[model samples]
Every structure is written in C-alpha cells, then in structure tokens.
Target: MASLSLWLFSGLVLLVGLERVAELIVSNRHASWAFSRGAVERGQGHYPVMVVLHSALLVGAVAEAWLTDRPFLPALGWTMLVIALGSQALRWWCILTLGNQWNTRVIVVPGLPLVRRGPYRFLPHPNYVAVVAEGLALPLVHTAWVTATVFTLANALLLTQRIRVENDALRELAVMS
Candidate 1:
C-alpha cells in the first residue's frame, strides 16, 4: 500500500512536469504568432522568478516526500488526488477554449477581445484557479504539508502580480478594440 501510494504520487508529479513542458511549447508558438502582429508581453521582470518558483515547487514536493519518508494518509491522499485530477481537467479546458490565444505569459495582442467562452464564462482566471488547486492538492497527496503550504503562499504572491499585469494588459487591449 505504501509503495503503491508513492508510485501514484510520483506518477502525478511526472505528468505535471510533462504537462508544463507541453504548455511551454504551445506558449512559445502562440507568443511568436502574437508578436508577429504587435502583441506586447508584460511582467517580464517577474517571469524568471515565476519559472524558478514553479520548478522548485515540484522538486521540493518530491524531495520532501522521499527524504522524509512521508506517509500517505488514505483519506487525505485520495481526496487530494481527486482534486488534483479535477484541476488538470480544468486546466486543459482553459487551454482548449483559449486555443491559440493561450500562452504562459501575458502577451496581449492589440485589438483582441477577452476570451469569455467555456470556463472563462464562469471565471476570469480559471487557469490560475486550477493552478491553486493543483498546487495545494499535489503536495498533500503524500502528506507534504510544508511543500503545500510553501507553494500555495509563494504562488499567491506570484499570481497577484501576474493577474494584475494580465488585467491591465486586457484593459488596454479592450480600449484598442
């Protein structure tokens, strides 16, 4: 049971890493397309920090669980696993709905309108919501409470800046459109 839980937790982290890489690939393509038409990226100063923080988060979660020999509580672990999976679905839904407009960074194309379909219809930043859910749930899956707490706090700071930048960019684009 313990071995199985560890395997499940490890698999989850691996999938998340792969998903992030895939998102970056698509983001790069979208960024190029946006830039070709005069889109401007905001929050460049904080981008590197965001990348590092997220990378460290995954690494920390794995390390904390393995090094500390964290025991997975079935109730907590299974519940968190469900939340993590649900978040992944939400994240992908955001990506598909946004289509080519979705990018990791804030690249606002002039004269383009805000996306209001699918999940966006319900929340302005559903992707971030998914991020928050996964960040909290993933660490807790293996009882990595420190990792969960740390990542959630750090992510809150990062998201505050990111959402501010995104909203400002969108507001500017709205005027142009």
Candidate 2:
C-alpha cells in the first residue's frame, strides 16, 4: 500500500511537470505571436525565481515523501486528491478562457481587454487560486505536510508580487470588455 501510494504520488508529480512543460511550449508560441502584435512583458526580475520555485515544489514533494517515509492517510490523502483534481480542472479552465493570452510569465497585449470568462468571471486571479489549492492539496495527498506548508507560504508571497504586477499592468493598459 505504501509503495502504491508513493508510485501514484510520483506519477502525479510527473504528470503535473509534463503539463507545465507543455503549457510553456504553447505559451512560448503565444508569447511570440503576442509580441509580434505588440504585447509587453513586465515583472521580468522575479521570473527566474518563479520558475525555480515551481520546479522545486514538485521535486521537494517527492523528495520529502521518500526522505521522511511519509505515510498515506487514506482519508486525508483521498480528500486532498479530490481537491487537487478540482484545482487542475479550474487551472485548465483559466488557461482555456485566456486562450493565447495565458503564459507562465506576465505579458499583456496592448489595448486588449481583460478576460472575464470562465473562472475569471468570479475571481480576478483564478489561476493563482487554483495554484494555491494545488500547492496545498498535492503535497498533502501523500502526507507531505512540510512541503504543503512551505509551498503555500512561498506561493502566497510570489502570488502577491505577481498579482500586484499584473494588476498594475492591466490598469495601465487593459479594459474589461
């Protein structure tokens, strides 16, 4: 049962990492297209940190699980798994609604309107909300409480900076349409 849980957790980590990589490829293409049409990217300074932090999140979770010999509490693990699944669904919805506008980095196409579709209709930064939930749920799925807590704290700070930067950029350029 322990090994099965670990394998499942490992698979989850791999799938999430692959998804991020795939998104990055799509984002790079969209970014180029947006740039050709005059999109501007802001908040360049913390971009590397953001990448590193996110990468570390997956790696850390798996490492902590192995190093700490974490046990799978079926009740907690199953609950968290459900939450993580919901988060993934919400994240995908945000990406789909944003379409070509979605990128790992902050890039705003000049004169373009803010996206108010899907989850964004209710939340200003729905992607970040999904990320926060995933950060907590993914780690907790395997009893990696330390990873969960650290990721939540780090992501909170990162999101604060990211959201502020994005909002500032939107105010400077975009209108809700």
Model 1: residues with Cα > 4 Å off, grouped in runs: 175-177
TM-score of 1: 0.94
What TM-score does each of the candidates earn?
0.94, 0.96
lDDT per residue (tens digit) for residues 1-177 in model 1: 346767778888988999899999999999999999899888898899989988887888888998788998999999998998899999999989998789899988888878899999999999999999999998999999999999999999999999999999889875433
Cα-based lDDT for every prediction: 0.90, 0.90
In candidate 2, what are the lDDT values of residues 75-160, reduced to their tens digit?
99999999999998998898899998998889999899888878987999998988999999998989999999998999889889
Residue pairs in candidate 2 whose N, alpha carbon or C atoms collide under 3 angstroms = none
lDDT of 2 at 134: 93
- Displacement of the residue 36 alpha carbon in candidate 1, Å: 1.5
CA error at residue 106 for candidate 1, angstroms: 0.5
Clash tally, candidates in order? 0, 0
